[model samples]
Target: MFERFSDDERAIEGLPVRLVIALVVGIASLSVMMNTIGGLTALGVTELDVKPQPEVVAEGSNEITVTVITPEGEPVANATVVAKDGTATLSQIRPAKTGPDGKATLSLSPSLGPNQAEGTITLDVKPPAGGGYTDDRENTKLLVVSGGAQSS
Candidate 1:
């Protein structure tokens, strides 16, 4: 077979051109994938911002509104919001979920302690499944002043 083919042709067949082409393609694909991942990472994580509500409320159930969004201002839906008090005694908050608009309203009832009439409420907001987004939380103060005194 070597008699019919030139020496150069035989050397070329031994070079494994197909294998080299496949390796190059594989590397290119991997590079593209890595770049895509890096880009997504640079986009940063999600953020949760609790709207400004009354700092003081009566000794009853109060409603709080929170908004979840991305760094780019995109609404984050289906996020979980948890509220708790420092002493966990004078605050009753139910876990709420964000709607399509990234807004969740939580009902909080200020508990009156033996001698305490003011306390802080913490809101923990968690992103949806996947680690692509980071979780955020905030704290707000609530003072139990009088009955039906309106939130201030």
Candidate 2:
């Protein structure tokens, strides 16, 4: 059997409805994405300023005091401070938490490799939760000298 089709006018009855649904879905998704991005920025972010007392130390057992503060120079209390080996070798590092004065004392025994003149000990801070504090920036570093005397 052979049939001949007549082109009167092709009708797209459901095309507009499908297009409208897609448009609505797209707008809703965009709105949700924008809100999520806006929420992150709405949460205030604070930068940590870590400082190690006696910036330079001899290659031996020493007690270093670390202070955590905000950019506004306000001390950040109850924050955790961790000392890690950067270019130096650390014997053991016990993470310390800051007190009301935003100061934590850490006992670190750093050693330098043979023939190594100097090295660095890196410090990191973890601000208290819900404080909107960020520790992504560079922190203070401690200098460990092989033979030089420790500085106050």
Candidate 3:
């Protein structure tokens, strides 16, 4: 029994104090860790970052140069160019940005049916991540085709 732990005629038959203390400390440490992580997570620090959808610019154009210039009229490179018809959406047309001369070539697709609305061509420009802003060209340009060639 525990009474025999002294210099008696018996031996202690139980775990040592050090082992018990170690187990308790380990459990407490784990609990604190879990609580800290849970609390930090419960705060508004979720790992969900959503980006605002880029607005679509419908200045329809065929063989047009959409120069996504900066506030200082400097061209943007490696930017995303999307042309959409009011009826259907064209696949993301991401061509290389303008060269040092600030010029990019754009060739409009004539796949839409003559009657399928061909809707409208909206030009949405996602400028480079640095030193520029998104350009909402607005209803400025509209490419109207006539005689199988770009009219305006």
Highest TM-score among the candidates is held by which one?
2
lDDT by residue for model 2 (37-130), tens:
9878635799897888989999988999999999888899999999998999997766999999999999999999999989999898988998
TM-score of each: 0.53, 0.76, 0.41
State in Å the error of residue 18, model 3: 56
What is the TM-score (0 to 1) of candidate 2?
0.76
Taking all chains together, the TM-score of candidate 3 against the true structure is 0.41
Clash pairs, candidate 2, are none
Model 1 lDDT at residue 108:
79
Across 49-144, the per-residue lDDT of candidate 3 in tens digits comes to 111111222324346565555545555566655555544444554343554544555665534545553344455555556533445435233333
lDDT of 1 at 126: 72
Sort by lDDT, top down from the best:
2, 1, 3
For model 3, what is the alpha-carbon lDDT of residue 39? 71
lDDT of 1: 0.65
- Which residue window of length 10 is worst by lDDT in model 1? 136-145
lDDT of 3 at 108: 58
Per-residue error for 146 in candidate 1, Å, reads 5.5
Q: How well is each residue in 1-152 modelled by candidate 1, as lDDT tens digits?
A: 45555554667775798889999999999999999998775365655454425656666777767666665667778888777665434445568888988888867776656666555566677778774666544533344554466765
Clashes of 1: 2
List per-prediction Cα lDDT, in the order shown.
0.65, 0.89, 0.47
